[model samples]
Target: MSTTALPDIRAARDERVVGALALALAASLVVQNAAVAWAAAPSYAAPMTEVLAFHAEHRGAVAIAVGLEALNLPLLLGFLAGLRGLVEQRGGAGAVWSRLALAAGAVLSAAFGLYAVLWIGTVLVADGLTGPTPLLELVWQLHAAAFAFVLSALGTTLVAAALTTHAGRLTAPWQRWLGLVGGGLMLAAGAASLPIADGSSLLFVGMPGYAAWLVWLLATGVRLVRRAA
Candidate 1:
């Protein structure tokens, strides 16, 4: 197949898998978020505590968190592949933005993965496997950096996808709207990550935006697949 045709082929195959990956990722995200959200509950103690508090308290949930978190690696790879597939086949402003956005997402995903690992390390330390360390604090700093870049990617991709269409027209107002809303949410989320050191409660405010971005990403993937088809 020609180079241009290759992405379409990949996109065709990816269309069969991206939705499934999205579902799995979303499920994992919900579980992960639930754990975080639960710990943030007013009834819960350890207001000054980090995520280690939650993992240590709910051991079962910790297993769930770790399991769900582990699944993200493959899902993220698949997402990046799908984005690449779109770009290789389409090769337009939309595709370029999508690639950058996916790159940002990948960075944030990696940072989150590192954060989970740090949490696990803290657990190990509490279990007497290691010494006390500032792993969690380091994870938070990485989180801030990852979120900043991810926000930029989100905004660029959303706008690019909104303005360009397969038909080569500046149509698809809904796509544009998704871009604006999703982009806005990411920026808000990035801002929220900054003040997180002051209090964990502020993280709660960022959740809705991330949640919206997830929804928008799923929708955008589906739209890309349909357009390619």
Candidate 2:
């Protein structure tokens, strides 16, 4: 290929990466939501025993959902790489914001990955465990704490990405607004979880925030796919 053709090939490859990342993220969201909702898994607010019982009975479904979520880890990394390249191409504050988004996404992905593993561990032992529900409760609290950090990082990633895209005229005005709102909601959810011991605190806004994020992921994925096409 000629020198001129190389850039086109590179650009196409990058677009494909973004498209692939979008699909992975969308699939992860769908599977995670379906597994939890269909299995009727207990929320963190539920009693320890209730939560344990649900998991004990529906371990297979829970595992499948979380497995799908785990599949997003690599896709998230790909997204960061694609965003970084876009930022470098655009230059200016877009560059800085993209770095921020990349950093935030990296840590967010790690945190979420760990959160999934932790839940898997808890579910595995839920059925055969003896007394001392407090022990498991403490473990659950720690899991929620990790999730809070994860959400906070996700919020930062979304906001920075939105700013970068908007500045570069890469996305629609409404999409940018959605990013801002979605980011704020995720941040609020993280904040609501400050009292780690009281999972009920997350009921107010935290859950809704994550639900919005799920929607955002789906929409963002579709947009990326269309852009690639």
lDDT (CA) per prediction: 0.54, 0.73
Query: In candidate 1, what are the lDDT values of residues 1-229, reduced to their tens digit?
Result: 6898886576666655655565566667777769756755221113325444544566665566767778876776676556555455544545655556566666656666666665555455444222224664454345444544445454544444344332233234565566566666656655655455434454444445566656655665565446446
lDDT of candidate 2 over 111-186, digit per residue (tens): 8887887787677667687643765777676677777877788888888878777776556777678788878878
Candidate 2: regions farther than 4 A off: 1-6, 91-93, 130-132
Best by TM-score: 2
Error of 2 at 164 (Å): 2.1
Q: lDDT score of model 2?
A: 0.73
Off by over 4 Å in 1: 1-11, 35-46, 49-53, 91-93, 125-172, 192-194, 200-202, 221-229
RMSD values for the candidates in order, in angstroms, are 5.6, 2.4
Enumerate residue pairs that collide in model 2: none
The 10-residue segment with the lowest total lDDT in model 1: 41-50
